[model samples]
Target: MFKYFNPNKVFFITSKAPKYVLILFIIVFTIGLIESLILSPEDYKQSHSVRIMYVHVPAAWITLGIFSTITLFSVFGYIFKNPNFFLISKSLAPSGFIFNIIALVTGSIWGKPTWGTWWAWDARITSMLILALFYGIYLLAWRIYQTQDQAFKVTTIITILGIINIPIIKYSVDWWNTLHQPASINILSKSSIHESMLFPLIIMTAAFALFSLLIFLMKYNTELIKIKNKGLDRL
Candidate 1:
């Protein structure tokens, strides 16, 4: 459950990723843009607005994935007595929050044309809003607390407890009579989407994942520098 990793080891690994990762991201993301905008067929019902799925779905996926991973990292850090996980979680929280906002905003944009409203209190929407709240709190803990120990204690506990919402968020449309659509892609079963749509979805998801990694690494390196500075001050 716990992975004991040195903070410096993280910096070392991510430092090597910049040039290679960015180039690959650029290629894939450009292809993703073309696929979503020009190549993919318009939905008969939703029409062109259906294109929002490319960005909205990927953002939703990243929102859940990042939060769940942060919870796991928080748990491991607590169990292993490694603050590095907390630092990583701290770095990741902003990206997660950003994507959560994107998902909701884009969902609202898509909903206006399709569902006739900017917001709905469907199970999925409610849970996603809850997640955004927690993500805000998670980031605030790091900023508001004067000590890392205090911040970590609060954040680790909140993240571990709040992650319970992820499964609920994923399954909300299924469990409740909701306006939100059920997942088009199933991990256990084959995806329900056409190959054309699915291909772009995959590319966009990869591009987003790589983009997120770049963001996290930047924040992680900043945190490492701050920690180093603090250590020097103590000396």
Candidate 2:
């Protein structure tokens, strides 16, 4: 099944994906903005400031999802001795890191009006900051290590350790006192959020996911090109 993971087999398809993805991203993003900014009802308390959720919530969700994906790929790459998996993980990190920062910044902006402060030591906020640091260290490991094997081993370890923070970030609101609000969206049960707001949130998340995919395709293609030039049979 994994044989199709080969760069030679997938390069043609991957190379052609960005333009189509970009068009879809533009369409979805435009709709999401219209729905979130104009159609979605304001919070009874927060008013228009609640609009920040359109960007912040989706960015945070994508950040967490991408990091989880990176860890899975890194672990599988190590176990199977498949360098291609590591390459995919490497290609994914930039977008995840970017969205992580977006989440933090937007959250801070949202916080000022909601929490009366721009920064806080709240559990969820601190945990997310920690996650960003882990992302930084993981990216730096790749740059600082002298060989592919060394970089792979170090990054695998970093992700393994960093994943411990994911649950902490997810549950911090429930586990302790925090300024951050409890989750309005729930997967196992009915969400507290109204359909009026939930619909736009979903669309925004799709737009962000498409944007992340676009970034990954570009980075992956660049790596593939480098491999082609270096005469590597697989990456």
Residue by residue across 9-79, what tens digits does model 2's lDDT show? 88999999999999999999999999999999999988999999999999999999999999999999999
Q: Which runs in model 2 stand beyond 4 Å of their true positions?
A: none
Local accuracy of candidate 1 as per-residue lDDT tens digits, 122-184: 999999999999999998888899887888889999998799999999889899999998888
lDDT at 113, model 2: 88
What is the alpha-carbon lDDT of model 2 when measured against the actual structure?
0.95
Q: Name the 10 consecutive residues with the lowest summed lDDT in model 1.
A: 1-10
What lDDT does the true structure give each of the candidates? Answer: 0.88, 0.95
TM-score of 1: 0.94
How does model 1 fare in lDDT?
0.88
